[model samples]
Target: MSEGRPRLNTEMVRLGGLIKQAEQALITAKTIALKQFDLTVPQYAALFVLGTTPEASAAQLARACLVTPQTMATVITNLEAKGLVDRSTSPMHRRLRETRLTDTAIPVLEGADRAAVQIEEALAVEFSPEELRSLQELLNRTITALHQLG
Candidate 1:
């Protein structure tokens, strides 16, 4: 090894891989759980966001969901076609469109949310309250550190 070179941390590398694996597993679980509601993970993500931020534009939803604008546009179109969301010209900006959940979507979103909570609940049961809090903090810190790198 070069004298000036730093040693690689195998434990940190393993942790990063585990994080990715866990994320993929969570997405898979969500996909199966949401299937009964005829929604995909991305669709559920959009609805989840819209549930809290009613009348958000596709751009806003895209940002919040961490997806590209084109991807979000497709999601909005699909949701609109399914009658799960309504898009209208923004009152504040006539040229810009905003989207909100329809009455039909409220019940579906509620059901999907319950399904998601079940997955979370199952995971939460494996950890003590204090441990869960610490885990959340660590994950948040990890995310912050990654963002700083970029």
Candidate 2:
């Protein structure tokens, strides 16, 4: 389509296709480790976010997890039901619920984290460190570029 650039089918060679397939693969593999603890991806996500930001409210965690507040409500409910997270009325804001991980949840989350690391390690086995670093740098640039476009 361009005057002098190499032409290719956009649909067949776009970033979205690659990104989506990679996500699906990772999710399928991750779901198994999480299932062993009776958790879903969103539930595990809630625990990880709460552990890092204990003061965050459900709304805040929802935004961080890239889900709507309504969907996150379900995630919080499941995590609470499993005793993995403790939700308290926010002292600073009566309408908000501040959430955090329970002591018993740490080991489960750690196991899930280990499982994720193993998946990433296995996926990276074919790549050299330099190649991986270059890919990361390029992906970072692409993300920044897309954000600027938006």
TM-score of 2: 0.86
List lDDT for all candidates, in order. 0.94, 0.84
Question: Candidate 1 at 32: error in angstroms?
Answer: 0.5
Where does candidate 1 stray beyond 4 Å?
1-12
lDDT of 2 at 143: 85
Top lDDT model: 1
lDDT of 1 by residue, 1-150 (tens): 999999987666587788999999999998999999999989999999999999999999999988999999999999999999999998898999989999999999999999999998998999999999999999999999999999
10 residues in a row with least lDDT, candidate 1: 9-18
Clash list (residue pairs), candidate 1: none
Tens-digit per-residue lDDT, 78-100, candidate 2? 88888888888989889888888
lDDT of 1: 0.94
What C-alpha RMSD separates each model from the true structure?
Answer: 2.8, 4.3
The number of clashing residue pairs in each candidate reads: 0, 0
Q: Can you give the TM-score per candidate against the true fold?
A: 0.89, 0.86
